[model samples]
Target chain A: MNTPNTSPSPEVTRTYRRLIPNTWWLKQRSTILFMIREWSSVFVALYAICLLGQLWALSEGPERYNALLAKSLSGGSLLLHLVMGAFVLYHMVTWFKISGRIFGSGPLSPGAVTAVNYVVWIAASIGVFYWIF
Target chain B: MCLIKFIKSLEPLWWSLFGLGGAIAAFLFPAHILIQGVLIPAGILPKDMLQYENFAGLLSSPIVRIYFLALIVFPLYHAAHRIRMTLEDLRIGWLNAILPLLCYGGATTISIAAVVVILRLS
Candidate 1:
């Protein structure tokens, strides 16, 4: 007995599915947002390293440390602060938006997970405020 | 666990507010003495220290240190989690375990290091 061919016909082209959604707006916005978030990490890391260096200087001696500190407080430092400040704000907002997605409860219940996230966020804000101020 | 999650959830907003507040203070109040007098001429910091140190110091003060630590630790946790998701989104399945471990491990190391420095300073 002859077997029938199962291969695709010559006129047909193979189709590929996208991992992400097909909405053009969503794809563009998400790509932009992702780039912002990823690059912001680098800035945050830079800020962390600067802090470590400050700590090192303070550990060394007063005069040297104070001078280094003074320089950062003046001139172009102000401008840099403005830029980093914006990036940091963006970072914070995006972080919160993504928080629920990261640690949400598995398929058991959806709203329950979101509720838990909001509660935690509010409580943390209160606690940090109390501690800081 | 709930309490921890609550704090974790609030972290990004809290940090954003704090960072913004600190940035404003850095500009309006202008810790000129701290930056120009101590950080700049002293010659130990990286070139960018001219821009970073004052804001960082303001954000990294003793009280702020606690906040900073929380922000650092939690944001990193958040980052790791998000990164894992992104990897999976991209169909990079094998890295799931390693990514989280490295992220949390690095975060913990940094937190410990910061704590040590803070304690030494105090």
Candidate 2:
């Protein structure tokens, strides 16, 4: 039996070089991370629009408002709420991960920036709770 | 880096934060019944009412106004930023310059309009 060459051909090496640079791996990883960060917004946007619809129904009439509200609070809505909750959590995590990359140093420390996010989120939650009740 | 160029780059950060912040606020909170139900439907509200606000009454409240401002301002910024990023990703060479300008310019316009309406209400 004749032994085959183990080394790759020069043409294959050139093709590989064209296909991916030394830094391509890092770029690929970053791009995937970026996509994850970006696409999470879809869930966030959908739920937000649903909330807007509820608001619209409320403005329309009590009957419509109550119906929408009931739908929103129904089991199906609850399931959606759970999904959205998970999505938002992912959003928050990825958001912070990219935050440093996006927002360079400013007056606020990284800790301070993160604290602001939590505080703002908590405050919004309280506002909504008060409004709903 | 040129001052203008540096400022331009920071635009993405501003927009992203604004968008993310607005999305977070909108999702987590239920619409305020009084605002969304009573005031907005009543047609007594300002035109620029937030989903949570049925009317402009909340605009009078400083705290509520701040929240509203944050919601409006950040989302537009986020949208603009995302649009710019999308364009950059496509690697369309010629359109790059005009794309960011339009995105940022449009965002600025909307922000101004919102501020104008809010200030007028006040």
Candidate 3:
């Protein structure tokens, strides 16, 4: 075996790593949308908290729960939840779209997987609404 | 052996939660949101849908409690995982060591609190 060189070697290439801007995601449309999709988790978690708040109010007895209901029925709360709902929808849509690929390409095609997801989503929605009404 | 060990790691556990939560949220949140946030508030559906006794009765069911808990908690872990990844991508890695603890720990706390509140609903 050749002995390892102990002295400093001339003009050895250092490991090359290019620095990326933190804002690089902002620069590309696809990247921006990707970031939004990921960041949408913030809204999902926030909305889950909102739902938990509803549950908490329920456990607190009727008066508090009705008061919370009254607040929710307001136009401002309506508008806010509408915006929140949009984020959740975006998150779901992007998720379902990509779920096709993550699910693997066995018997079902990717488009078929996506279609099945949407079908199930709509059926679940209808089933819940029916149960509620 | 290495692959199995990796699969058994906390990463996969967290990732599985993320995927499961994403699937549940995608399938469920839309209809719930539409009815609760839009249709009801828009006066299309009556506010009685959320009236205390009715909702309380709904929550009193053990299965319903568990369903709602899964709905709320899984997505929390899902969100936690995504938030951690997103923050790292945004070059916020200085807190690398604490990031998982913060994210997963917060989810765990909320989950416990959710379980407590939900179990007491009856």
In model 1, the Cα lDDT at residue A100 comes to 46
C-alpha lDDT of residue A69 in model 1: 60
Q: lDDT per residue, candidate 2, A1-133, as tens digits?
A: 4357677768868744233332332467777666655555555544444543543454455577566655654456656665655655666666654554456367866666666666765676666646533
Worst 10 residues of 3 chain A by lDDT: A6-15
- B52 Cα displacement, candidate 2 (Å): 14
Q: Runs in model 2 with CA error above 4 Å?
A: A1-30, A100-112, B1-84, B87-122
After aligning candidate 1 to the native by TM-score, how far in Å is the CA of B45 from where it should be? 22
iRMS, all models: 9.1, 8.5, 1.0
Ranking by lDDT: 3, 2, 1
| TM-scores of the models, in the order given | 0.46, 0.49, 0.90
State candidate 2's TM-score. 0.49
Predicted model with the maximum DockQ: 3
Name the weakest run of 10 consecutive residues (lDDT summed) in model 2 chain A: A17-26
Docking class of 2: incorrect
Per-prediction TM-score, chain B alone: 0.44, 0.62, 0.89
Question: What lDDT score goes with residue B14 in model 1?
Answer: 46
TM-score-best of 1 and 3 = 3
Q: What is the DockQ of candidate 1?
A: 0.09
